[model samples]
Target: MNTIDEFNIDVRALNVLLAVLDTGSVSAAAVRLGVSQSAVSHTLDRLRQSLGDPLFVKSGRGITPTRYTLQAGPHVRQLVGELRSLSVGPPFSPDEAELTFTVAANDYQRDLLLPPLMASLRETAPGIRLQVMPSGIPNPEMLRKDVCDLVISPHPPAVGDVMQRRLLDDHMTVFYDADQREAPESLADYLQSRHIGILFATGERMALEASLSTQGLSRDVAVTVSNFSGLPAFLKSTDLLATAPYRMKDHLLKGFQRAPLPFELKPFTLLMLWHQRNHEDPAHRWLRQQLIDVAQGLES
Candidate 1:
């Protein structure tokens, strides 16, 4: 097999190709790389000339990577990752760092955490860019395929090489418009009422729902929305109920009245999961610490 030496490209050129492949467009790659679109195209031209492969071709509305590009993409990603780990120079400084970090989280966590996180980054690390993606149940393939830098979810991918840490703990509680109806008084009452619940595209059941199922119980979900943000719309001014994390009172599901579940269920921990490759990376460490601080601030 041919190594990167055969391509006659430098690390910068490899990064250009990688950014293009990772983002699926020259324009988006430019944004990720903090450069102009034309500059990214020029680098791709250089890569094509050096490697004798078109690398990418125009697809319907966007672009699609060529077979050569797809085959070599993983190797290029690994090489760039290896090159980035070399800390032979000066100490790390967040203000001076210019790179993109991808985070996978659903709307609940996204709305709760990203706003404060972005404000902190804008002030302390002006050059850092956060690219957030939805994390549905957080499967191992997300980390294995280099999908994102970190995952914020209750269900961490059960992989040996993945590192996870508890960020915060919260339990589900019933949410409803008090103007419409009183809170359910028992498990039977909770099941009898119409529910407006979250239904992610991944079809992974929420931990609360899954646990209830284990006890031979389930909600009569009359309406379903993609994320927690959509719950407020259907729940307002109606006799509908929702069960979401208790912290949501300060986040997305504000103004809506909440009550504890009439039955017993253990609380779940929100966790931050990352691949083993990032265990010792300084920038990654700083990002994780910032998240820890943000989570701590929420409770105080």
Candidate 2:
């Protein structure tokens, strides 16, 4: 077996390994690394030869990590994270820095966060352009791969290695057309009304359903969509009501009327998450601070 120093593994190869481990397949790793599948395979071969072990092998359909990989994965991840931290230097100067940051958030967050955030950036960091990517929920592995610079979600994932900061507390509200006659005033009335729910491909829609069931009532789901932005449009044409965060109601559906949720639901925290690898990056720190400031201003 080669010593850690004698191994002389290329940083690029280590990066490839980390990507594959996080994504669970060579093809996926290739996409994340912005390289061809052949390149990822070649790097895997080199890593296997150097390590004298099959790091990953094809299982029934997908690749599974071998014993060696399972043991070495954490160390490799930590090493790569440390290296990335070392590569990032001082805080970026807003006026001089040329950067495009990608942020992952849902439509509700976009409504509440983007307008003010853009205004602040225009006044302070005019050179920085932000790209908002629609994200369903927090995924730590994706954050580590730098798929998004930050994730703004209602709840943080249970992963310990990721760093999270609470931006705001979100409470539920029911929205309906302002001119609607049969506005729901009680849980029973709400259950009788046609409801529209915004659900992603992978989301916790069942949780809301289950919560309603506990109250001995169920919503008649008239429509299911992926985002809250479209709900107001749907409500405008019909009496169908939708449930969403209170913070979004004012921004997305200005003319729509909202009422408190009939059944009690716990308030959820909106958190900003990033990989531990970026925890110390000066530019990342500045961005995180700006986000906090924006959220605080909105809440105030």
Candidate 3:
């Protein structure tokens, strides 16, 4: 037998050896590989020179692998298999994948967006799991710490390598129980009204409060809550007004009435955020696109 380092080796030559051994005929192996018989024979000659083994011998009208080739066949098959696996990344198939994703969202985004997202996932990626966590004023540290895969928020991180896209822009509106009180007809009426305000964990007051403070006017905040979902309960039985996004009419403000804010408030833009590391990942891209689609559907 020749020394292992004496002759150059190639994967195609190894494959030819496996095919010849399995079929016990060069012509049949060539058919399996879509090659001419002479090509198969030439590959076999190269493999024989490299390994210094008469890998096959004539037997009647067919062929038989030598004892040496038979003894090494399985190991050779494994080596070829491993080499193939190393040649490329496996393509992503959402229908066949088993994956879990996490999202950080405030109660507003969670209630407004995720239910439709989950419903869509159920149809498109049955094997995928979803986890939603509170995203109280998202920052880059949350992503750097691997706290969540994506964040849905109105606030965007100020740090670099944090990617974002605006999902929708929503203007503030006054939500109230129509049966309890009439909608505020003027800025003076809105300011005089008792309000239920949202206080984020970060100590950043809601945009309405900031806007009012900027104009040297403020509302009588009779109650403070953390999430939009709870505003309906407070406003449902009383004359208290909840200043919330117009989109809340479909979500948290159902059975309540909403009218445009009596004063001009700059619209809030809801954004989707993710770390740079996940930007090019196929599964992450797919989920992002799914969210974009859901947002578009909601707007339409």
Candidate 4:
């Protein structure tokens, strides 16, 4: 077995090769490495010359790994993983660790999760900073590429090389302004009323539709917005009602009112997703566990 030193392939070059294999394009890999596309292409050329095989060939839209490259890909990825793990120190002490973690979540989860999360961070992990970004359905591929440090969503993403843990289950609930109209007494009334649909760009709009279809009823979606925080303001003057997770109801509509869904909508299990790259990092593990605890303690 030839070691990296014997092959004259440094860790940086191996990393560039792994990035190309994972991203399937020199440009994308370059972006990930914060280098120009030409640099990635040159690295690939060097790797091919050293290995005596065309590692990747241009496909219809992107590059495809050759048989030899495919065989080596996993090994290279594993090497990078081992190196990262070895470099990481003991679990980070929240009070002393200066770190910033990026989390992607939908507006509903953001409403329910952020307040308590921030409060906990302020009290216990003040040195650690957080940036909450709006994420649609979680994308494991993006997570693996380090686009997001964590994803908090109803369903775990279906990307390979990622880990998921169920945080809590949140059921759907209906919300409307306090004085807009009387609370819907039944599913029939709920379906017939004008409704506001909150649509995340990547989420399935059919979940609510399917639930309504079961009762042979449907909603008149007067407006479709991108966030739950705006639904309360939208319902201020109209008879429009909004539906969201039960946990989000109180936080999103603090001054508004809510009622149970007229029809039985299955609860969605919220899961926290992270890349395998950070699986062994103590700080990462601590943050993940803290989120699970906060989510589990929510009243829903």
**Which number leads on TM-score?**
4
Per-prediction TM-score, please?
0.69, 0.71, 0.70, 0.74
- Give the per-residue lDDT digits (tens) of candidate 1, residues 1-300: 335567677888988887788668899778766799999999998888888889999999899999999998888877767787785356669999998999999888898888899999999999999999998878765875678999999886654447898888888898999999999988889999999877688886677777787898877889988878888889899999999888899868899999898888799888999975686688888999999999899867
Task: Give the 10-residue window scoring lowest on summed lDDT in candidate 2.
Answer: 201-210
Model 3 C-alpha lDDT per residue in residues 1-300, reported as the tens digit of each score: 788779777888887888787667898778766799999999988888889889999889878889999898978877776776565467778898899999999888898999999999999999988999998878766775678999999887775447899898888888898888999999999899999998877787888887888899988999998778779778988999998888888877878888889878898889999975566677888999999999999889
lDDT of each: 0.85, 0.82, 0.85, 0.79
Better of 2 and 3 by TM-score: 2
- For candidate 4, list the clashing residue pairs, or say none: none
Q: Which segments of candidate 1 are over 4 A away from where they belong?
A: 1-88
lDDT by residue (tens digit), candidate 2, 107-131: 7887788778888889888988899
Better of 1 and 2 by lDDT: 1
Stretches off by above 4 angstroms in model 2 are: 1-87
Clashes of 2: 0
TM-score computed on alpha carbons, candidate 2: 0.71
lDDT of residue 259 for candidate 2: 88
Ranking by lDDT: 1, 3, 2, 4
Kindly give the number of clashing pairs for every candidate: 0, 0, 0, 0
